[model samples]
Target chain A: MKGLVRTAVLLGVSTLVALDTYSAEPNARDIMEKNFFVSKVKSLKTDSTMVLINDKGQQRERKNTTLLKLQANGIDSKLLVKFSTPADIKGTGFLQVEHSDGEDDLWIYLPALKKSRRLVANNKKDSFVGTDFSYGDISLPKVDQYQHKRQRNEQIDGQDCYVIESIPINETVKTNSGYSKKITWARTDNFLETKVEYYDVSGRLLKTQRITQHRQVEPQPARWVALHREMTNHQTGHQTVLNFDKIEPGVAAPDEVFTTRYVERE
Target chain B: MRLRAAISFAALMGVSGAGQADDSRVPESPAFEGVQAFLQTRRVSGALRADYFHAAKRPDQGSDLLGVTAQIKTLPELGERIDGKLEARITNPALNRDGASQSRLLEGFVTLHLAQADLRIGKQIVAWGRADGINPTDNLTPRDYTVLLPFEDDQRFGTTAIKLDTYLSPQHTLTVFISPFFKPAMISLPTAGRTLRETTPARTLANSELGLKLDKIGEGLDGSISYFHGFSLLPDLRLLGSNPVEPILESHYDRINVLGADFARNFGRFAVRGEAAYVDTRDTAGDDPGIKNPYLFWIIGIDRTFFEEMNVNVQFFQRRVRRYHAPEGIADLQARAVALLNALIDGQRDRISNGISFRVSNKWFNNTLEAEVFAVLNLTRRDRFIRPLLTYAFTDHWKGTVGAEVYGGAADTQFGSLKPRRGVFAELRYGF
Candidate 1:
């Protein structure tokens, strides 16, 4: 009886130690999930400016207002974007409803046409409004769509980050996505993504995105927001920078604001 | 007219002054004030456009047209429940006889907003259609066929009317329109030693037009049903007096009723749209040789985007005339020719006519340059019209476009009848 008791105690202690070690270094999937949840807010509104720079270093700018709301069920999000600059594209609006279990819904309104049109949401690899960013790049990615693996721990720009590599888990997603794999560098303390590198299907470097100008909005929850982001295409020598001029977090946005009716309204 | 101009000028000055006051930190000077006032007004915006057209048949068969369009609107804050807009256009053509120089008011309207509805009064353009390029239900608006413009949108002409729009919900809306004035579509046809005159219905309450539309927007699909009771924009040709070589023809408007419905839906990578309209003419018995019979027109279309940016749209359209019969009781050869021409132009001879149209467009260089091809083929008549265009934006406010309109088939067919009008056009525009 003494021998049996001693063996049971030893097994329990070993199991506890192993769990502590495992918890210290969480898996890539858990880290990514944490990153997603930490970045999400109840609702947000922002005035943004997008600058597009070509190989010649010439730049063009576009101004827009964006609104986002997380559904009450917390499984869906609605986003509305209205462009106000460049004269020709003024009064253009886009509305999107992102779902976790099914396909997303997207609609676009052109003031010249004076009508709203529904767009295919599955073709997310297309460039968004002549910008370098694809629709998938602008949207929040589904965590289950990819298989994530921990690459290593590294310091980027004096900040400690956990580098994670994510690859598409299915052929459909792989074909639909412009990138085959993406490596993300997320800050260890706040889970804010600092940098991301995308790889083409040929395993070649395609683009790199860097986030900077972090601002904390809510002190209690320690919410950090990225006020500026820059994406550069390596093959094309084109770059796009997004600057959030104003951001209001936790704002109240009704569902009607995300509907097509509102998009079509001047 | 003087009162209207004064009011518009005052509104523009008020907006400009307010805008300047907001930027009071800048040092004040006469030159600076003048520049600032011109730049600050939100009420006025205008565009200057110049176009040149050349025909393939004659090297000298070309015209240069310069035009300016101005739009003015009341300030939003000052017009919480009352809003107004005025649009005016002036054009000068170098070699066109239709009009050497003309000035016209494109749109002028005042709107009163209510809790659940709004009312608009005066001359306005009320566009009603879901399909691209062609709309079977857009009968309220009149178009100018003689306009020397490359874009179809430029052909629209406003009509004096009163419109009431009621919003039932975010998904549904009801609209009613009343037009006390009658405007007929103008088509420029070669007289060929004949005299032609157009007569419109008298502007009276008895001849007023009425239209109603119920629209369902959003909810995964968009659709609308509409009804219009008014005079047909197309005119009917009547022989007033005739001789062996010189004939006199008068074009007169006919009363008609139309019921229309349109729907659009998206499925995965494809979008589908359908529109149908039933038109009833004044000839109920279908035996009158001078009036048209009832007809049904429909269009179905599909659109899709591929290769990231290329968009393609294809549509099939058909028009079926009810109780159709060829014209008879014509004794003179010239009269028979006139009757046949009238029958074809008025859609009175064909029992069934169909056509297919497609538009393919793509943009490059960050949307600075666009290339498009639009083609329509009349299956029954074996006639076709093709337009290929390229547009480039030199700057944010400056654009240039070049295109050609080509027609083919027998001269009696719809597109072929315009074969002599086939031409290539180039345009440059600046917007401010």
Candidate 2:
């Protein structure tokens, strides 16, 4: 009985030591996942103000508010971006629907074009309006589209984070590839992405977008208030920055808004 | 020259200004100025390369190696509401290589585009219509320079044109533009630049000049179509001058009339498109040249992805040239589609004599790579020839090709002059 007790104690120690230890260094992947899964959000439905400044430091202001909603099912999405800020952009509206099949659709109505163009199977690498941020960076594809791998913890915009990488699977696409691979850094507390690096088809670092500003919500646990994103494309000397203001999430969006007919005719 | 450049510069500035217009892009907020500040920090990030070369045809060809061309373009910029690009190109490859009076190619010109309408001035290549020759067109013939007149095989005429484009609706797009330019020499024949007077029946010869053109284009389900009209000055040489009589000789000049239209449509794996055009050309009463030459061209193709890795694009193109004679000078300009086909296939791999060609890519390597193999066989009994071509894109930017052209016919046959039968070519290119 004494010998058996001693052997049992030795086995327990060995098993405990064999387990791999993980540290609490928040990386990019953590930031990406955290920003993606929000347990709660609020909507403004009222007029919202926004500002744009060019590389030359010239500034332009616009007022626009959107009827926004969110969903997390077979398809996840956000709906209704109505420009209410700048006088000219007062009525511009668009809907973004991201599907699990690895496609994100955008429907935008431009008064000048009279109707909206349905941008389907959009190029991931294409800059959003020539900004540092590519359309792909802002969109979240179906969860299974990427093979995720964890990397070491890293710092993004001075924030401690966890780092993760994702690689694509589909190959039929030849030209206009958005990114070959991506490195994402997420905040340690909430797992929201803070920074990401996009590689070109040639596996070269094409662009990088970093999240700098953050705001905290009073009620949510580990959830953030605001996220400021900035992107830079090395190939083309261009950049884009996004300032998502007072982002409150809470609204029921219509499913029909995601259809092609709505995108084309607005 | 100063006026021309100034006009071009002003038009370029206009287009560039157009790119800056967002139509409805308002900043997201008052403090969002950082976005633009970040983008402006990037400098022009691309390279430019230009080359010029000339080849002599024959001794009597009168300096066949005539012109030069230069072109430059900028790279795509990241993060701007509207990315702008600029291009300037100039060329003069019209050296009368055919030993005839008029050798035309790129009469040479200057053009600039700031991501908007294209503004061009000076001598340049302007193509009208869609037919191979019956109608007027350019850009189809290889850089080899030929007598594809009315179609201007590498031929360039001097002119200034502006092209405007606006997206009317998400499903529809509209473009409209007008242009004016100088005319060429009259002693040159139909393509040699005839004066309006030379085109008239009253004078022994009539020539016309001072031309104007206008067009309207619209995008459709599969593609787009454009309609156009042109009025120009031309020179008449009914007397047919010989040698050079600088300060003397009798020549008439008058206005010429020209009008045409083009259409194209492409859908998925299968596409059918063609062009039909007519030219009511005027010539001397005794001139037996084909007057109402009608050119017709069409292409039909089926594209499919055989498996996950292999892609195939099979197509067939048919072209016909019909000439009209007024039964006056008793001259015969005899040319047939079959004869041309035979001339194109005289001696080559793949087949002996036929107008039909088959193309296939990737039977090996599982298709991670691509290769297009084409063979043209001539079935006509009169003349025979064969052609085979293979091209491949090694990587995203590197591509190479090799092709052979061969033809054969009897001594008195229509394809008698093309004895050397085959031409071999190899080339490699990389994009930045």
Lowest lDDT block of 10, candidate 1 chain B: B56-65
> Model 1: per-residue lDDT, tens digit, B1-432?
334433443453344343333222334488866753564356445566666555422222243333333333222323767877676777653333233566778777888877667788988877787887788788887887777667776777789999998878756889999999988776765576778787889999999999999998654578899999999887777777876778888778899999999988877667888999999998888765556678898999999877667889999999898877655556666666566666666645467999999999998766668999999998987889999999876655566778999999887777787787786776666554
TM-scores of the models, in the given order? 0.84, 0.39
Off-target runs (Cα >4 Å) in candidate 1 are A1-26, A34-40, A99-103, A169-171, A200-203, A216-225, A250-253, B1-44, B55-77, B81-84, B95-99, B111-118, B243-245, B327-349
lDDT of each: 0.76, 0.40
Candidate 2 residues lying further than 4 Å off, grouped into runs, are A1-144, A147-157, A167-181, A187-266, B1-54, B57-167, B170-222, B231-289, B299-316, B321-432
What's each prediction's clash count? Answer: 0, 105
Q: Give RMSD (Å) of candidate 1 vs. truth.
A: 7.8
lDDT of 1 by residue, A118-214 (tens): 6767667777887778888888588888899998999988999999999999866765676789999999888888999998777899889999888
lDDT of 2 by residue, B174-268 (tens): 44444443343322222232221333223111211222333322122223344444332222223233344221122333232333344433343
Native-to-model Cα distance after best TM-score fit, residue B396 in candidate 1, in Å: 1.7
